[model samples]
Target: MIRINAIPLIASRTFLPRLPRTVRQYTSYNVAVAGLTESQEEFRNVVHDFAQKEIAPRAEEIDKTNHLPEDIFPKLGEMGLLGVTVPEKWGGLGLGYLEHTIAMEELSRASASIALSYGAHSNLMVNQLNRWGTDDQKSEYLPKLLSGEHIGSLAMSEPNAGSDVVSMRTKAELKGGKWILNGSKCWITNAPVSSTFLIYAKSDTSVAPSKGMTAFLVERGFKGFEVGEKLDKFGMRGSPTAELFFDNVEIPEENVLGQVGKGASVLMSGLDLERLVLSGGPLGIMQAALNLTLDYTHERKQFGKKIGTFQLIQGKLADVYTKLSASRSYVYAVARACDAGKVSRQDCAGAILYSSDRAVEVAMEAQQCLGGNGYINDYPAGRLLRDSRLYTVGAGTQEIRRMLIGRGFNELATAEDIRAYNDATINGGVRGLFYGIGLSLPTHYILNSRVTAYRNLPSPAKAFGFVMLIVPCMTITAEKSGEAFTRSQYEGVAKRELDKEAQIEHERWQSLSSVQKLGDWARRHKYGLVGASWVGSLGVAWALVNRNKHQTTSQKVVQARMWAQGLTVGLLMASALLTGFDSSKTEDPRTPHEDHTWRAILESDPHLNEEERKRLHEIKRAVVDRKEQLVKEASNSVSK
Candidate 1:
């Protein structure tokens, strides 16, 4: 007997499609993108408070005066934010890339311009300098760059070299113990105010300036140095940018950054961070825009009704949510990869390339939602819109970033690479979790939060934080039961015969830590994530109508959808518990891998060639198998 009920799915259809757009988007990615670490979260709160109190309050005035954010950096220095990614021993926070990006998100909410100011120091110049600078140079410069006392800036683009570094004309020639530097760099951020600059200049006769480029630490008092005319822009006025003239300035012999010719690494890698940071800048802006638009639409009324009542406005809000949420997850994933150490240049380029393009789309949409108010200076969306244009321009243009990202993908992706890539994923899945979550505070907290959020979810719209909880719950229960039943269905002799081939020595058995098993199982059934969010949202809504009077009909509809979603999610969890190869025997509650019960067969295992390729096939098989079994089980359970 097949039991099919159209009633809940019907209600889901009504409610899930109508959720407040931004709310749904954010909820979808809470776990996928992850969030700030406990330490970083504290820093984020500190930054938020600081931004609100110091920067947000003064943003209007700063924009009006087109002033440089010279005053803000002192406090940022005092707070240890400017050097968050700089090594701690070197007079900086040493929090790393993810934390640094999180800080950017919070600070930029106050002022895109000010955020860029901090970015110019850490992302553009300081990090590169740390990687490429000489020992003497590091001891002398790192402390200052990390300190608020010495500002770091990059002088690479000239009037002619905006997106084309190969076209740079600035030249430096050997002159005994000094290198004679000539030509000028334009659009240099923190110019005039910045104390130190990573000045890139052509050093050889290689015809192509890019191949001959050399990076030098040109100090503020360098001879024959000047800040050119300060130019005004459409937005982000609080941070200043200008041209830097190098009129045959002399760099000391020891000032050679990285063996004179290795400047390409300095340029590409530093710019990768620049673009990544640039890509991340808009997360805050988009989030702020979402918050602002939500407040504005809900507060403002037309025809004696809130504008939020109209489907048109809801539609606009949904678009903003979708774009921002998608972009945020992608950025976080990429940023986390970089933070994990040695992110490929191609990966970094790909992420930022996608990020900036999305920023433009979302920011513009947010502006549209504000209507006439969005155009006026009184509202923030308009300013953010103009300010965000630099995201597409700075750190390299969107067009060029696309070219770089595309070229990278062209090289990395191929049919021959598929098996190797798959194996890597499998290996990374178990071990990556061990290392990434084992040491990472943010990743640990994020998963914990997702589980907590799932447990606390009472309605559809609010219950959307994590998708991992569901698939594993259902898949494990069904798979284990089926296998057990299949084993039971055979007669004693048949079952005994079957067990031999399928099973090996207990000592040979490899098991996943409960968390790893859950993650692996969940990854297999990832498609259920979209199903739960969309369908579950509707279930929660409808469940609300039948179950709770406090909620409006629409809200109730959403609750019903969520309730349905909760079932699927819970089932996946059960599935994981039942079918995992190794039973969890740990008593530690702090984290899943506490006693190291999880073991994966990677290079040592004969079953899998490569971790990535093995995991890909395993995941595909498990998930598809789970789905087919789930439908049958759901039918049987309902019929009974």
Candidate 2:
């Protein structure tokens, strides 16, 4: 005698309910076609269970005590997660990027602060050594990290050099045969508890700091290696952060990580992986936020009825879903590139940028829906909100991402810039320009102007740069479209994708529009201002470079080489700006409400699907059958 058709039934048919499957699909599995292997899945289950049972129960207590993840380093090491990419010969799992990213994303979902501590220990610090360290260094250090015998910490940030990396002041002087390092590293995670450190210092005081920088492997037991006072932080309390003081630490030439003048190279090369891990860790955090918010909205009732039934709440829920899904898709695109052996600095930067930015957005929405209760620290959302704040500012600020993006404008049409606006910067005709507008500008008007300018023709080298400029268009495609890349768009058996996109667009816009448009006039005020600036910068750069008239065939070939280099620089910068933004704010404000509401239950508890669920049930039955039989063996063994 029960009927569930209870709410706004008549009006339901007027609105599309199911989300567009393309966005839905991309949102869920952003990594690419490869799902987890059975073993990988088992690893996921064990880790998930461990997190839920151990970490979740104590998360509040641990967070309150500012319990750093140092004590937990041994546990993650035991789980074979740290050496995800190192060769097993060096005591590592040698797993690919997908698996590593998955582990980061999943564990972080429970408590991002803990995940950060553990991830930095196992991933950023250890993996960097594995990738670039000499055989002696690996033999000496990798095993310690893998066995959890030694905790590795990175000492990159200083009192200065947070974003401007080249302006470091730590000095390392060469003393006859041994190098004496004398400086202090600040804001170092795992510093107080760390047994090993990857320290970057300037070897030659006179040369450019970034260029003369050298990397050294320092151990806690070293004579001059001492831990200073621990630095208290707002989030990531699950990891011990401290100032590391080094006073005339004598390190032999043997301890050098790479070549003397190659510290910058080592740090830069390792940074790509660091960014990848950092980006991957937040995927799980967002997923958890979604699940928690879903539970609260559904369970909490108002006015003698489930509040979730109200259109206003449902609209909020829908918006949360769409934003999370879009961010996931963006993360997955970057993951795909990284997993496919495309772990360039640009690729990782893009991944970090997109994931971090999305994380802030999703986390904020979760906080908002919790209403007054969302502000309370007792709830995970409160902690997540505080924890997520550091993403944009810690590694690189959003402003830095934007500025870096500015460098790539010569290539990526997706970025907006000031120069693109006619008299925008000078005459104050417009403030900013965006790329989507430039690309979508009326073709006749835009191209006619370009064609008129094209009359000058320029030189072969400059003309080739034009081709490089068009290459980013090659990246445009549906988030989940399965197609070979074209120079400017997608091409393949994409009939299904094309059809799904229309339905997807309608739903996506609907969900996004529900959040109340701030002001349409403000949005329409400038179109593609950033992109226009990018185009203008490229134009100016082309003008400044002297045109070479050398018509030799070899010289023509050299220009081709130049084009490739130019493409790489622009693409990497574009990817960084477009893909690598971590947060929308330098510091995001969050307040947890004192009370909250919830729906009965949630999704992304990461339960098995129907078939898998059935299989799990069957396995449980089989385990029960074996339990009684196993008691006899236990008794016999005990008797023996």
Candidate 3:
């Protein structure tokens, strides 16, 4: 027997003991999980050891029997793994989300079904209670649930309302000092064996769907409350899922989980954390698949050599390993963010979305690596594949995650733009005030010359000039004065016209199908659009210039071609700008400081923080002082 250190050498940054070449060739070592403290590493090892010993052996049996081992819950409770995020005063380990995520990942590596059940109980039920439950409700339910003496579950989904939770028909009516729940919830995890449930119901239908919902604490023994038959799921067989039926189930006022009409807030508060922790399930499954594939590739032989020796097999191994490492790193990074109290909806959704999709691909690759042996139940690859598919549909569907991420980015960009606009307005006002004072004579001369020219024009030209120039100047003056005078009356009318045009454009864009949009893009850029357009215009001009019999000199023709080519290029550039083709998208528009006057650069960087802006101002002052000193030296040299 050989002994090897299980701690990851990379994580500890320590030297490893040298071993014989033969020993090193046959040994398989563990890669250190990153982003963990010493205590977190120890906790992970403890959970990993327990899971392999107690859960891995029974994983096959549990899958086949479609039932979890009877003592698994108690054993997990005894190890204090049941209430990972609960406070110590509430009979839990009182750890943060990172630790909880580690526990989920290790357990999932052993048995995904068991890990799913654990997450549902620990995160969905226990953590919610810890966060939102009243003191009395906590005293009554937290201890039993935390100890794993009684099972817990959360009910939010209905038969018709899985992704659209706000459409749930579960109504709760306040009647005679009690709330009566009168609807059903389906596809609930741990429903068959759970003793307590955190349920949401529509309390006030008059209000909006989000505002009308209320969360309640209901027990299994409540009158007219019953758990239906367990669902025969495609995967996660051992985690019992069933429908819950309620017919006039009475709940006391004290059992309300949060405020009467704030269930959405309570539900939303836990969703990001839930998504973060549950992401570990997919990470574990990916690890497990990689593990099975590595062992089989090493042992299995083909064509007088090990299959792992083949280039194709080695490539597959590399791909899977890279994916697993990348996914693990991303998940851990997001978990750390969550633990640091920087929970972002988009980040959480994005973490699970990316990991879950990759897990499926990794599982399929693992099965492919095993070749014929992968398809059979004898190998765990088939089970891993089935389990890996559940995540993209379970917490929230992949589609919902994408939409959430898009909306989050849209909101962030809009807020940033608004802030930039406000900053630009303040800076522009100050600069305009100083310019008006310093350049008053030049500004007045320019305006007076334009006015006199307009007055000298014909009646029709004068009317057109007034509409284009005079009205715009007047509007600008009125807008700068906060639109406080007579021009303010027409401001609303002009705004309405602008809004109408914008709405028409928006609707036109929305009406185009995705295929149409793609086709339009292709047409717009076909045949190197700008290049071809400019070249074609120049060719036409050249043809016309050569065909002219009146041109007696080659110099005039040469000048004509040059003017035509320059005009064509300028028009192409202008068209590109108007069509939103930004040629400098990769470059920061605010950069190349030497191109702008110092004041211009300082005015443009409104996105910089106050400290950064102050530093920039100091640099500008230093540059000005240095230039002034250089000028003085030059003057003294000339005088001498």
Candidate 4:
């Protein structure tokens, strides 16, 4: 046998080891999970290592056999992952939704199917128990479920009630001392293996589902309860979804998860958290796709050069990176909101809506990058693509999400104010007249400049910005009329016009963040300040032009004085306009326009009647909601 000098051959000039250390280091890429706290990042790293060593090795086998990895549940329990959001006192890790999200992302990156089953157990069942279970109920089921001694799942969707969960046919009737559950839940994750199940059923058919439904904790050993045949799925096969049959299953009164006739609350609340956490699975799929593409692009060659070097390939990869980054950022921000107890229904929907769609696209692109290899089962890229497709149709379809988001924004619009911030006489009547005369001119000039910047904005945003610009001019005319002028009278006509324009533009201003809305309003109004200055400058120029034509020395002196005052106001407006260049600037040295926080806007008119006060309160609430939206968007940007 010839040794062939293997060591020397490996260390030859053409080998990578023979390359300069700096060259090697510079060529390597560094990728890290974004938007995570120190502890979260550490947890993610640990989970990544665990998934790579244990889950990835078994993923192929699990998929081939279509088996749920029952052994992994105990291991997850040992890692304090089974009860991620459960309180420590209840035999859990006492972590938040954000941490749970991190674990989900890392695990799903290796095996999406396994992660699907894990999500069904940890979030759908365990977290719901923690959120609504009575003390005795918690003590009875939580320990076993959290310790992996018992598997858990949730049953909500039925054959005809997937997106419209309220239309479910499942029912629980009170008979004697026990409640009897009838009807079946289909497409339930972990159904075949779950030892504990949180089931939703209608207790009162007379009332609407929003009020008549109730949640119950059902044990697998219950007399009439049975797991139906395991579902044969095209993707996420190892999760082992099945139909659950409840043939007069018996439940004690104490088994009710939340108040009777109020199961909708429990269901809705859990759905929000469910959306946030399940988002991590799609995020992980995107990440896995990106990772695989990166490696393949570096190694695969075409035309004697790496295929990744081509602009088209680079473009595809860049898009994948951007999508993954944005999705991760948005999901994490929503998870943080869930932890802080400041979550919004629309945001929960938005997070899943955005991430799920992007993940599918990113997975497809990843497979595309691999050419023929990605189409084959030998590579995991095909599997990632298959798994990612589930998000668009699962956990409420994209259509449902769109309608919910639109409805939420429309509600906010119904409550929003349609008038200028403040409209009142200043320095008695003289100053108000001067403001009316000069503000419109400078306002026009400033507004003209802003047109280009807002041109690309959504039609609603553009219309809003336009209406905002003209409000100050309208207010000036109203205030100039003094006590005889009611801002409401002028506002009536202006608002009608604004509403018409908004309608024509199809503007959904309510969708904008509070900061964004404020910015647009301010930018539009700043032109008034500019108009004031331009009016002065134009006046001075006119006076100077006709200076020699003055009939008397006094008139000449008066013209000179007019020119001087115009110079001052003109200079003031110019400096103000200069500062206005940055639309984000919320502070102004001369006026309170920049300082118009939602609180300040609310306080601008505190002496209103009851009806006005209520309207103002609604407006204030809209502002608060927008601010939260701004925070979430900002966090997403920073994370990216």
Candidate 5:
């Protein structure tokens, strides 16, 4: 008799309902990643303490007065934050983008305006100069900028060109030993306060906008260069943004930032870091919002109960918390990748885009949670909303950023490209580990090929691979498992966790409910599971037989057979209770319109005459009238 329960030990439902909304002190909430080095933790603590003690107190005054905190820069400089991304030889901290992002996040948590100005100075000007500036240029400007004696800003956006920065009107012409710059930059952060400005202008107007642009390092005192009126606006008030007028400004030949006609390269290269670093601003705002909401919910009462105790309030809190956690994870991961010099362009756009949008939503929700107080200026909720709104439009508009991300992914998504990426970057860590273990040559090659093949498979195939890999082991152990967990029960377990590590483990266990459900669904289809097992076993056996034909050495043949047997047994046991892939199933279209609207309706009934159209219109009208009537009734019922 066939061993029908070959993998009964593993088949159990993994997926389940989410935890219930509950209010409690998550005091052990440490948001830092578990693998943080000692130095990173120390640095984070230092920055957090600095933000809380030095920056937080001044945040209100800064917002109220709408004044740039010139005094704060010196303290930041003294702490070596100004040059965090710069090198030691260049009067910088010699740290990486990760550290820079940490500083940005901490500072922004206290005040986003301050953080915005800091980013414009540090990442936009100082870091770019460090990367592309000549030795003499660094020697002349690095020390003063790093020490906070000089402030710097970047100028690219112009009156008519914000998202289309390459089409800026600023024009620079090479003259005798200097360049004549004409035109003005609007909405320039740190413009009035900056001693140095890195401006982009068209060097060759005849060519394409991107190719014609050139970068120039213009000093504040340069002739014809003037700071214009400051723009008073909503939120980020203290950041001090203004127009920059360059009327025949004479820039020295040595001030040419990068190669003429290659300013686009300089500009595009710096944007990744700018986007990554600026993301911290939103992350900080989210954190502040979360803190404010938590405090407000716990203290404020309504309907004879603390609002925090209400499930609705708790649900809002949970959403904000989840968003903040996810944003933090993405931002930090991207920052680490930047530090590792392996940044993906799409991910850079994605991080800022995702975090920026979520930050605005979370801030608004925080404001809503506070009710009347959140609406008024007494709390920082209004300010947070205003500041967060700027992100959706700044750096790059959300629309443009979305296009960039989609375009980038489309360009890179190819079989060969995917395989190369896996070999060069994605699998580097694992490959190194295997190399360290001194695996046999054939084993190394085979494993790498397997991993590459797995990665290159289509999405559906990958899903199958995951199920085939996981479902068997779980199915075999299902007989030993206990009853399912309720949502409230899961939350209780999560809350009682003593530390971040324990909390993460509890979360992982809780998330298995959905997986368990999937496994159960698979178990319901017995024939499919058995067939998959046989197919997998036969495939493995056939592969081993073919390998034996090529193997001259007896040792190699033995090893191959052993590998085949192990894999076959593993597959058979796993697949005994796992579901098979159904080729007949069609993928759901990834579009918003389920029915394709009126076009689909018209296409389906193309033979209909004018009479049919008239009838359909009448039916639609009746439906609308019915909907309005129902809505009115619902409103009346609610009011009563």
Candidate 6:
């Protein structure tokens, strides 16, 4: 049998060709297998073997008893799975997110409940501490937690705060150099078993909810700290979840995780990675379900033949396989992106959202393939189905995920529009500045006007003029409104011209390959382009100066116009150095029409009294009527 280190040697010539020579010397052929490098695949294999041999055997018992084995964490620690993403100096494996994801997937494949608890301990607690904890905090907490001598958990969700965590009621007040925490956290995973807890509370409620919060490291042994009864969960039964009570719990100032009043930043820093890692849980469940179904299908008989041979069973099997493959690919891809420090919030949410939904469907399909056996607890399919459902609700609900993804896309579009509008305003300001300068040169030097006359005006008049001139130049509203009005007056002519030009530009852009397009964009905006324009402008200016000495009156007038044109063009080119040009369409800044639906109105102002609601409805009706009347009047005018 080949050892783990020897994997690269066997396929060095064939599989290592695509990789860099340095990387190929160190990497393995598994890069081509499942997007894993040698080290990642090797780590995955080790975790998988340990999980299948140890945890898989106890999964059923853990589910039935609603308790994970006492020795489970220690075993995991021994395997270096607890700190898969932590540095080796902290008694961890010093691996990256992909390796951590693989470890989670393999453990979850054995027992999802155990995996849930593990994720809470390793990621929600340990990883967060590693990131935000002070050196002393890390030194104090990391060793025991990593060694499995103590469990860790993060407490953010309170009784009234889940998705809206900022609205949490837990409060912490500093009194005489000690923080007094008085509040409770509910639905906290591993709360019943954890030794160290990362707790967030409102440290200064006078400020905004998000800004006033603080995170503290609380020990289970702290005074007045209590863990309430373990929750009776329908799924993930073995994961010990409970409410935590803090009553006059005193914490030292050094115990503050990160800075006080910056808990939101600490909380947000880990959410994307948290979502990416926990996504592996659903993926593992899907794989487990598929595996159980495939085995049962091959062995179990129906209609005098193996059920796997039947077309319907084969179709179900194929669907499960396809979903598992797709979900795994997405999870792995996201994990790799996270490791590369290129995380996307929407993609992170999307990965969990898509995988969790697909996992539920796949789990149900797995049970369906088992026919009668699937519905019973003995088959493990029922448990898989139950476990799979939790993912949609946990780590923010699927509804929250969908909303986040939608908001992310909306923000992206809005940002692009804002960027384009800013670019247009800057370009317009540059043109105005150059034109003002060009006009000023002739007015100040040639006309010989007295500058002191304007300066002698009253201070108020000068201030008023400055405000009027600057406000219009600084704002985009006036410029965009003017452009819109001009287009409206010559609508047909402008539309035809714009459409023709747009079509030609679109065709030209589409004809270029992606690489060519990038290169073309680079060439257009390069410093060399600006330098060439400056050189040409200088050449024209020199020629105009030379010709002016020998020119007739009309020729001199033409030379002045040429100087103005050349100066304007040169300044425009120089402006390119200051800002990027965006050709993207800018959105109009008009307010959108109000929602007329009752649900919309209720959501917008949920606390509205009956009288207020009636008044709002009446106002809405009047607005709608006025809009319709305007439309009718416009139509009549057009007809006339």
Q: Which candidate leads the pack in TM-score?
A: 3
336-454: candidate 2 lDDT, tens digit per residue: 56655455566567677777777777788888876766776646777777777777776667677655555544442333522332222222211112332344345434554677664
Query: Could you give candidate 3's per-residue lDDT for residues 193-302 as a string of tens digits?
Result: 89999999999999999999999999999999999998888888888999999999999999998899999998888888889999999988988887777666665667
Candidate 4 TM-score, C-alpha based: 0.62
Predicted structure 3: lDDT? 0.76
Per-candidate RMSD, Å: 26.6, 26.6, 24.6, 22.0, 30.6, 25.7
Candidate 4: count the clashes.
Answer: 7
The deviation in Å at residue 566 for candidate 1 is 40
By lDDT: ranked, best first: 3, 6, 4, 5, 1, 2
Clashing pairs in 6: none
Q: What is each predicted model's overall lDDT from 0 to 1?
A: 0.68, 0.64, 0.76, 0.75, 0.74, 0.76
Candidate 4 — which residues are off by over 4 angstroms? 1-33, 412-640
Write down the lDDT that model 2 would get: 0.64
Weakest 10 consecutive residues of candidate 5 by summed lDDT: 7-16
370-425 per-residue lDDT for model 5 (tens digits): 78667776578888898999889989999988998889856634676455544444
TM-score, every prediction: 0.61, 0.59, 0.65, 0.62, 0.61, 0.63
Q: What are the per-residue Cα lDDT tens digits for candidate 6 across 304-381?
A: 787788998989888887887788889899988887556788888999999999999999998888666566676688
Cα error, residue 169 of model 2, in Å, equals: 1.2
Model 2 worst lDDT run, 10 consecutive residues: 594-603
Model 1 — which ten-residue stretch has the worst lDDT? 3-12
lDDT of 4 by residue, 432-487 (tens): 44654465556555656776764455767655655665566555655565443445
